[model samples]
Target: MRAKLFILIFVCCAAALLFPSMPGTDSLKTVFRLTDEPNEVIVRGMSGSALTINISFGDEEVEQLIRELQAPYPLLLLDMEWAERYPEIVQLIKKRNIPTGLLGHAGMNYEQNLPLLNEQLEKYEDFFGTKPLWFRTSDEQFPYTLRNALWDIEVNALGSSVRWHTGEPPPVIEGEIISLPHHREQRITLTDFRKLTETRKNKSLEDVLFNMSIKTKKMPE
Candidate 1:
């Protein structure tokens, strides 16, 4: 009876340790267990004044992004399929030193597609000559299991703070990460994006992220 009681206590303690009561604050904290819900850590260490646009790679924005945008490349989210389809464009993006991130499937059943992520990462490295550190799973349910897997590989799961589509008023530049879905039929064009940038000014993903790193270090322990 004592042994059984001890085992029960141990299990309860373990559970409490692993799953503490959700904090009331909005601070960035890592999830320790499997969860299908979106968590704050997806946008961990994010705090900035300048807005960042993550462009979903498409043919329409190629000229605008490469030549028009000029310096401080906007973040481009690319996948293996798109890379294969437009190798020359990919090369152009590379030559221009545009910041690119790995784009995941629309609705990935991670249990089955987990291995596929690894394969894509390998191909991404081969094509880009560097492993992707930023990953975007477009409006998909990102399970904690997958997030943990990504974190294990030193890759961060990114969340878009605002999503802007064409024909709508520009999104207010309040969030750190703003998404411009160029891949969609009705998406924000470079013309629209430039006007928005002119209003508030935008920063590169690298610059914003580097700022985040500095903010995290200075945070109170």
Candidate 2:
């Protein structure tokens, strides 16, 4: 009982720090466990898979990738540098309602880079005429200062792998922010990812995920 109580306390603290303005551990943990199961009732309600790609550098490839995906893609533009290269692409993303977020690439040092993050957030809003809903740093760990800053701005936090090395569950809520893992528990190969993205238009995300599950089980580790 003591161990369970400690875990509950730890989860609540972690959730509060990592995801601000979100619900408590009881609800969040349920969601985390739900996300862990692919065919669970919670997952099957919508029956779909989603992907997020963080853009660390600038190039025409970024534009091409956006052109392929219509919406629900959290494109984390690393810096303001991409503004010049993909101005129109950014505009297109806004037009399509594709979720745009910021990435802390330059070490994402909250103390030192806070100014940079603020500047880019303003510029992005100006560029797209809308603010971003999410903010993600390069690393999985969310610093105290950064987490509070994101909460203040009402931007959600998106980071971490779906599962931790110690086998802890993913974070479900913070405040207005959500602590999400980019990958799922069921690992898929690079080839599977490529196939899913490349043929996204031709197939629904659920179909790809289902197919990938089958392919992965057949492969020898």
Candidate 3:
């Protein structure tokens, strides 16, 4: 009797310990997150005018290769600092009526330089006849400083969000800024981009503008 009692007690203790509570399994359903949902906001172009392949010097081969790209595929995404040094390139591009975009490296802590940035924007407009379509602190990192800097700039001054290396979508802001997908190089054939632009015409600019404003509000402030 004692042996049976001992066996029962052991079994009861083991069961209690093993099944302390009903095992709850977490749902592992993965969902695709939309970074850029198709909305009323129709960004005008498809192919980025040019891929921001290189911003610094010493890549002569790359620059040459970029120049060899077909006409209308003007290599416009250039470094602001590089443009300052090679103003001739800017002039040449403008003379050709190529759509160029400038990426400025105002640094991550760029909030303090808003005034300077605004002045620079005016200078660009004066030189290029229009402000660049995009501006970001850096090409790789997206910290709070970059966000603050972007917020400080006039809504219409910049074009697209800076490409982040993290593959994370940029914090949406008011305007038709192209938020590139992560790891996706901003390079595309003129033919392909042209197709994208053609399709975009189906949407009105006002719709695109409204969507952009809505997206900006959704971003974490």
Instruction: In candidate 1, list every pair of residues with a backbone clash.
Output: none
* Candidate 1: segments with Cα more than 4 A from true spot: 1-40, 44-57, 167-175, 212-221
Q: lDDT values of the candidates? A: 0.57, 0.44, 0.39
Per-prediction TM-score, please?
0.68, 0.50, 0.42
Candidates in descending lDDT order = 1, 2, 3
Alpha carbon deviation, residue 130, candidate 2 (Å): 2.7
Greater TM-score among 1 and 2 belongs to: 1
Error of 2 at 214 (Å): 26
Best by TM-score: 1
How many steric overlaps are in each model, in order? 0, 9, 9
For model 1 the TM-score comes to 0.68
Among all windows of ten consecutive residues in candidate 1, which has the lowest summed lDDT?
A: 212-221
lDDT of 3 by residue, 169-213 (tens): 334333333432211244433344334334322222223432323
In the range 1-221, model 1's lDDT, one tens digit per residue, is 23443454455456557766744111111222111222323342234423334444566565556667666556778867777777887888878766677877653566457887788789888897767766777653466667667767767667665566545545454335666666645556667767766654466654454332421111111
- Please give the lDDT score at residue 113 for candidate 2: 67
